[model samples]
Target chain A: MERSIRSYSPKDTHKIGRRIGTKAQSGDVLLLVGDLGAGKTTLTQGILWGLGGTEYARSPTFVLVNEYPARLTLYHMDLYRLNSIEEIEDLGLDDYLYGNDLCVVEWADKAPGYFPVNHAVVQLEVIDDQTRRVTVSSETAHLDRLVMAIAGGADE
Target chain B: MSDQDIALAIDTSTRYAVVGVSRDGQSIAELSWRSDRNHSVELVPAIQRTLAQAHVSIEDITVIHIAIGPGAFSALRVGMSTAMAMATGRDIPIITIGTLEIEVHPYLDLGQDVTAIIGAGRTRLYIGTFKREDSLSNGHVYLEDRDKFLENLPVDSIFCGEAVAELRSELIGRLGPDYKIVSAPPPTRSASVMAEIGHAKLKSGDTTDLADIEPIYLRSSQVASAARRWPNTKTE
Candidate 1:
């Protein structure tokens, strides 16, 4: 299932992320695909907030991954610096992606084929300086409730 | 005792980077710590520290033993290459033991089939089935989905390893009271166990050829071949 919503401001985007995060389960993976400044980190911050994380979530670009404790542990990964599939593979991603945690990957399009089959892809497209279109899609029903939650929240 | 009596064991196959120094099958010193993903940076210094603590010079170490893995890809490489390089530099024999074998070693006395598991990310596991009589063999480790593996487990099968804690509820729920699950102590504390296994292999002449030994990465071919593409690239 898939859902798309338009965010007229960064705050709106964060709210959408929070909605998704609240419904996330352990072992859930959210792949964020967007250009620079497309609010990936902002959305992640909102997701972290939704998951009951108090510390601010930052871009783990140089560090590659940053772990935040929440209702379910959040493993936030940034692949902007990794240029190839091998670089991503060396991240030992299986543990986070497969373990009992919620993993959110930034720049996930860097290796489209590298992630597991069951994951939700969150794509963001900038419409203007302050507007963006966020699309969440997944083939498996693993993320159906999350998609529904986001869709339901967007209507409010 | 001759130089051949000192053994160094390295296992960076999981979150823990473990180093142990043993002399004549007895442990002299050992260190194990959660390394996150810093194995490449942490392993050499760990080796130095363990050797220093044991009062054994690196040059006096005659054998190197490594846990080749069905584990973290880069972590396993860090341990394997360090062991290989040290062995090559010293012109000593290097013995490679399967990580699962080391994991299953402490449970072989139960006289039951033991299934040792290492988490393979995403509710999948790298599992090794060891018949009590032939616990030393390395031919049985394979990857399987965790739920399926538990559902099909034989009655009275004993399970152990780092992944056991996470699977305890599931194992008990699915298999009911017919199965047994033994949680091993934290892996870092088991470096001495790895050293003992290495020592036994050393005494039995089960050393690996320096030129042919490679890390045992039991991933699917797609991921395996992709990893092979950048074999020379440093992970960190």
Candidate 2:
């Protein structure tokens, strides 16, 4: 995927998230990487909204994943709950990863696998109390267009 | 484009059958059920029964009218999707109608800006516009989360729909004459109406491909929709 970076405030993350969700179709996997409080879940919230999810999308920290069946079921997963790769399989990550629905995995780095390269990875950084810097990555060119669209284009 | 053809319309936006038959934009048979039960089990059977009652078969159906919801998300999905799949197999066209549009139909004493809304879990509403003259808007818009409703109403808006019964007084007190409270039929999919809309669009050459068709879920469940709710970022 083509690499792109964009800077946004935590508040702006949701709008970016919404854009992704709106365009997200069934069978799309989004891997999100960011430090704590970096707005990963906030962006995911926007994604859920874009994907036509009705229920609120929250951090799945306690639960590894929360499945919301909507126009397209949104599987919100937080890998932070998993201790290791061995535990990922038990959660049926693969079932949803390639399923006929959209999936967003927060803190995906904690699980470690093809997830890093096979899908779009949005890296968000907390630059200051009110600022966030994002670097979006992916191996597929399709994702580059998605990232560019989500990050708000050209300069971003 | 067949005359006197049968059509299957399904409305799962709320807890009702809102199903029926139509021939060239005319209602032949219409059936609805009132229960807070799962529409999943009931929608299909109701459709089949309606067809049987009308003495129509799948082959007789020229179109499928599915109520696209501003109601329960899951219910609308079930109804729309079921009809969508069936229509695809039969090679028929699928038409989508909004829940609020059905609610604010020609029967109500609505104002020009009638807010035909459906409850969106967590006190939010899905809205459709209407004219006091007894006709509804072409489509519906979401009120998003309720916390934002009062903050961003479309102005001169009157509230209607299943959500009105509970939230009426509060909304009226807040918005005033802008909020004309009116009794509306519980939201249901009107297959017959869908036929009218579909037939009109088809005649005007306004239909979309099945694969291109999707539910009009107002917000994205994806990160993108989240952006709409997120505080818009100020560019420096």
**Candidate of highest TM-score:** 1
lDDT of 1 by residue, B1-236 (tens): 46457889999998877899988778899999999679989999999999999999988998988898888777888899888889988898998888988888878888888888777777678888888777477348887777678778755668888888877888888878775888555562377787788888888888889888977655654455554554333221
Candidate 1 matches the true fold with a TM-score of 0.70
Model 2, stretches more than 4 Å misplaced? A1-156, B34-37, B105-111, B130-140, B151-154, B177-179, B188-192, B220-236
Q: Give the per-residue lDDT digits (tens) of candidate 2, residues B1-236.
A: 54554567777776565788877777888787874446787777887888888888868888777776655656667887798788889897776666667665543443355666676543345767665564344444654545466566657655667777776667777877655576554543455656676566556656567777666655323323333333322122
Number of the top-ranking candidate, with DockQ as the measure: 1
Candidate 2's error at B46, in angstroms? 1.4
Reported per model, the fraction of native interface contacts reproduced equals 0.28, 0.00
Candidate 2, residues A1-156, lDDT tens digits: the string is 544445456557877777778777667788887788888888888787777777778789998889886678899898665664436644546446645678888876554443423478788877788677766667777566566656554224
Separate DockQ for every predicted complex: 0.21, 0.03
* Every model's TM-score on chain B: 0.88, 0.76
DockQ of candidate 2 (2 decimals): 0.03
